[model samples]
Target: MANIKEHLLNTLEELATEDLKMFQWHLTNNVEDDKHIPKSRLEKADRHDTVDNMVQKYGQIGAVEITLDILKKMNNNQLAEELRTKVKNN
Candidate 1:
């Protein structure tokens, strides 16, 4: 079987430098462009509260995991670029 780490590294290497920049931007931007929607519970709690911690805690297959899975299956480089941009950089 192909190693996932090697595949990720290869994918990273193949992406254009600017695409990488955009990817990073999407990861950090989170709710940019008035797109920050809240969950049912959070909406009842606080409008300005960040959902990051909550998601990291309770979300099964957190955003990063979901994004990686989607990236692996969709095989759409553009979608992968968008999804990766929002992921927290290690």
Candidate 2:
């Protein structure tokens, strides 16, 4: 079985550039009970804008690492499995 870091990197590798950006947006925005994006910045915007914001706030590696950290902290099997499935599907 893959660990969190492995899972994230593998998923990152599998995703297309646009999909990866979307994933980054989801990491920073969606995901209930977990707010990675600041309250001030949560106002509606283009999803692509979120990708640019993530690039500024977290950079590529930082985005992946921060997301992995959040997912680990959440410790929800369903969420984790869903992410794994998304990774596989994409």
> Which candidate should be chosen as best, given lDDT against the real structure?
2
For candidate 2, write residues 24-52 as lDDT tens digits: 55665665444366644634544445545
Q: Give all candidates' CA lDDT scores.
A: 0.41, 0.53
Off by over 4 Å in 1: 31-90
Q: What lDDT does candidate 2 reach at residue 27?
A: 65
lDDT (Cα, tens digit) per residue for candidate 1, span 1-90: 433333344444554655444333333444344432334433333211222433443352354453354345435557566446534342
Assess the local accuracy of residue 31 in candidate 2 as a C-alpha lDDT between 0 and 100: 50
After aligning candidate 2 to the native by TM-score, how far in Å is the CA of 22 from where it should be?
16
In candidate 2, how many Å is residue 88 off?
Answer: 14
List TM-score per model, in order: 0.35, 0.38
